[model samples]
Target: MAFRVREFELALMHRMQDLNAGKVEEALHGMSASRAELRAAHAHWTRLAHAPRAPKGAAALRMALGAPPYRGSRPAGSLTCDVLRWPLPSWPGLAFEALLGPGGEVWNQWFVRPEGPMTVAFTDLTPWACVVGDLGASFPGAVQIEGPAPHHWTVDFPHDGRTYRARFVYGLIQRLE
Candidate 1:
């Protein structure tokens, strides 16, 4: 079967379920999907991701999500890297981004707010409402810490003279600590 964007989103939810099963379940319901569907999507995604014959990097992404709506270049330390972005149905305001190295290897893949000035305040830090980049932009002083597991991240930011830690799975905010 051909992998598609919906399967990509479901695969994302599969990783996110570790942090917020309830929210993932609700999303599955909203998509008119079931746990079995989620599992299958994830399995399919895994196969495509690791298959030796499968397209890699941008080609793979295009195969799954079609041509990206946005493509550009960004600095990656001493090297410049290519960036590709696609909008997802689940998050209208955010975009899924993949950063690729010079050799066309994917360096990172995550959700990011499209270019614009974001005025996110502490009160806006709700679960599943924001991405890691949003907090870094809104809270300039935010410090990133290693997450408890892979595909997870934690950021500590100051608000009202106190610090708060935001936990994320697959770069999407999961909870506030």
Candidate 2:
């Protein structure tokens, strides 16, 4: 039951909305992945949706942000508000990031390949960045960082084969150079 990380996230999202959704079934019938793989992921998502709650919006957000991405998911990395160490994800390092607000609401969330090709969100962005779904790498790639003079940086996407640097502020791309 082999499947890509993207597929698992999509299935999990669908299953979260409706446990009985046939989206996974469609994937199986279309041979997108093995029936076993889809079924296992779907089951895991069920447990997440049905997991116990803290009963308050803020508490729930805090709980969810603290909880693992999913059952048995490995630790990825820690959040970096300003100048902090954000060690790259090991190997095919893919991590889901969640930004919380002062009121304990989810301000933003995205998937990051700390050492892979940069997504559009990693470049040419301004205030109120759009939320990007979880993304992963099929093969390991490289990403270079410049500086955060005042909590800003330049992420080089060499894989894109461009001669520009992607500037980031608070993990959101401010512009490209």
What is the Cα-based lDDT of residue 94 in candidate 2?
Answer: 43
Give residue 66's lDDT in candidate 1 (0 to 100): 99
lDDT tens digits by residue: candidate 1, 24-53 = 999999999989989999999888879999
List residue ranges in candidate 1 displaced over 4 A: none
Each model's backbone clash number: 0, 0
lDDT of 2: 0.39
TM-score per model over all chains: 0.93, 0.28
Q: What C-alpha lDDT values do all the predictions have?
A: 0.88, 0.39
| Model 1 weakest lDDT span, ten residues long | 110-119
Alpha-carbon deviation at 102 in model 2, angstroms: 2.3
